[model samples]
Target: MKSAILAVVLAMPPQAILAEDVPTTVAHPRPVISEIVTADPARARRFPGVIEGENVATLGFLTGGRLASVPVEAGDQVMQGDTLATLDQVTLQQDLASARAALETVQAKATLAAQQFARAETLRARGVASDAMLDNARANRDAIAAKVKNARASLTRAEDAAQYSTLTAPTEGIVLSVLAEPGATVSAGSAVIKLAAPTGREAVIDVPEAFAALLPPDAVFSLRRDKNDTAATTARLSVIEPVAETSLGTRRLRLALDNPPKDYRIGSLVEASYATVSAPLMTLPRVAIAIAEGPNGPGVWRIEGADRRAHFIAVTLGNTIGDRVVIRDGIAVGDEIVTRGAHALTENQNVGDRLE
Candidate 1:
């Protein structure tokens, strides 16, 4: 019975069977599409940074001696004239006392010599003392007087040295580090502490020379605690180191923050974001591009009309930025291109959204 039914259907008109075998092709909706336009014209670059001071000063003692006491430590706040450290005062006091004692002895000898010279002068006037003896008395008195003058000058310097034995802060600031401790001997002019002025806070960043070359003198900056945080604030470019660091191939950039957060102190970690200036160019989604086996423009399958038919259009590509590539030519704004399944498309093929 089945063979008989099949034979009856095949005996029908040949035109009816041919028409039922071939189905008509229909234009379908596009799933993924991209419009040609200027995309992300400004390129933003980020660098890690830290808060720093413009005027950081390293302090040391003027007179070398064994440190007897250190009143301030790291992270301590200090004011002008505040004592930072003190050298052993016993040796200083003894030196001062010796200078004073020496001065007293010279003064006593000078007094005795003057009195002897006076007696000799009186005797010489009465013709009782020899001329040679009188001359010797005068020379001793003058020499002792010169000795007294020398002793007085030595005493003055001893007093000054005693004063310099105590190290004091020159200005109000926060101490960053203390290199010397009590009982340690340090030489004069050797750094004992590091201090930074609390006036201007700035961000220091090491940027690659390639990126630094494109940055303008007046480039703008924004600093944030982290990359994902939106609580960022603005900063201004203050200086760029002229010489590149040969070892790192980078240059240091100093940016001033007019209104930084209260918690943003010296050495605070931050991220600096800034934009690079470049000429505007046309671009398309990276997914819309596909490699073809030809020499000329690796054509893109462009979608057109309400029918959503795919057409292969050749184009010239430039640089690639993030998820998009620059379209130098052969495409204009408002043109839709197939972003998904471009590899499976052909010229004038009916393409549409695939139902999941």
Candidate 2:
């Protein structure tokens, strides 16, 4: 029976055998979007900024009164302790006198109460005064002493107000604006003069939330007065506003100038740009990167030269600059990388010829 079956199979035509064979899946070299890896400095993002004082101040009195005189004007340079403005002294003096008289009255009353309290204690020791009488005398003395203390505090405050009536430069600075005029009645804490301190000047720039979010810690900025790039100088990020400006959705960045020019004065219009600190790093578009399918994860599809195959290589990502991201590792300069359809690619997939 076995010989008979073998003879019948051999007699079958070659076309019949070939037709019944299992088919094979064909994988063609896939066309890919790619970019040649190159190391270059990051594109700088420019912003408009202004030079401002380190700690600007608005001068005002602690107590409200009619302004007698304003000795300084906008753009005037004043030294520490220089008089900026003064309030009418008559009201302050009258208040001081009232405080003094009140204190004197309370002190006199306290003295009389002390004498009564002492006499009451003596009488009580002699068995001539009742315990209730001694207690009452002590209470009266305590109450009068408290009033004296309160009056003295009032007197001290009055004296302080006398000095507060005169507004003086707390520090050497240039007056930026005059808020109040002479003879104008102003309330306590009302702005009288705007003063910009001589030191702690910085560049004030509004950075969008997206850029500020990716701002590197060591990032430096180049500043130029107006549009003159010829006179550019460097600065370091010093401070950022905790809150974003509501209207523009941006944060205020304060960049401390490095050896700023003398012409970089207060309110100077300037332009700022971010500068990279380290050596030029490799960059790739967002589409070139993929998550997972890599041994270390968050990798890209790298195309090898000899085989022309795409392989998954995990990379360390640096700061995201604009649309491209910096690749810290896992690939070197001159390596071709897939920029599109990376996430859908499998390991060792044959990629078509490099589109140089």
Candidate 3:
């Protein structure tokens, strides 16, 4: 009987099939990349930096004098002991002459006193001079000798001042900046030029106060000349400035770069990247963060329970590290946060299992 009915239905035909005859397809939940909320992944935090010499020396004069000539300009590479600047040579020479004359006069007086003391000693031995007279002559000779010694010391100091009129490079390096010029009255120990040594180069970056505490010591930093540069250099954390910048609240950090390429010269602007092992705050991909409406700022879709329902969670945002941003408050560790395909998700929507 079933065969006869099937044959009759097949004969009934081409236009006889009804639209309701088709089976209804069941809709499954949407699949998403529900990544676990944790500390920032090993993505390095990149900071714009400038290359600087580690052994930076502030060159200045030893004697306060009118700057006669500043021969070397900024960016000039100089050798150790090379003349960088000079004070007034005429004034230095005059000072030396004055000191020499003073010394000569003192020496003449000392010689005359010695002769008088010897004559007094001879008279005292012959009973012609009294004991008090011999004592007076000896005291005069001693006082004159002391004056001569003081005058000689002053002459030596004057000679030194003459030599100090010339300011020379203390080490082999490039002149970073020239602060003083000719005819400028500069005091002793006043900086005239800034010099950076040829070696011990480093990278300097001003990190935001938000990430200052999270920075690890001796952390390796990837350095590059430009943002689109493919070739890069590396540096390690050397030191950090204790004081924060008053306006921006950023602390300066220095990283040691060993044997960097020739392009990594001092004052060259470069980008520095450092991957932190443990970030102070948890971070999520910017793609996962959604701008909330009204009082709520930014937020992320977090999945909960075995049912795999996504809930819109409001999060306070901090600094942005690359494509990721810091979550100052919002989610906790081990929370399932949707990293991919998060835009279309609704409140309490059932998202499918984590996508590979």
lDDT of 3 by residue, 32-84 (tens): 88778766543456788888888888988887778999889888899999999
Residue 115 deviation, candidate 2, in Å? 4.9
Judged by whole-model lDDT over C-alpha atoms, candidate 2 comes out at 0.86
Candidate 2 total steric clashes = 0
lDDT of 2 by residue, 10-32 (tens): 99999877777967678889888
Best by lDDT: 2
TM-score list, all predictions: 0.54, 0.70, 0.60
336 Cα displacement, candidate 3 (Å): 6.7
Worst 10-residue lDDT window, candidate 3: 272-281
As for candidate 2, its clashing pairs are none
Q: Which candidate would rank higher by TM-score, 1 or 3?
A: 3
Q: With candidate 3 superimposed using the best TM-score fit, by how many Å does residue 18's alpha carbon deviate from the native?
A: 53
Q: Model 3, stretches more than 4 Å misplaced? A: 1-46, 60-65, 119-135, 163-165, 184-190, 230-232, 242-249, 258-261, 276-356
Single out the weakest 10-residue window by summed lDDT for candidate 1.
34-43
lDDT of prediction 3: 0.84
What lDDT does each candidate get?
A: 0.81, 0.86, 0.84
Task: Give stretches of model 1 more than 4 Å off.
Answer: 1-45, 61-64, 79-81, 108-150, 186-190, 242-244, 276-356
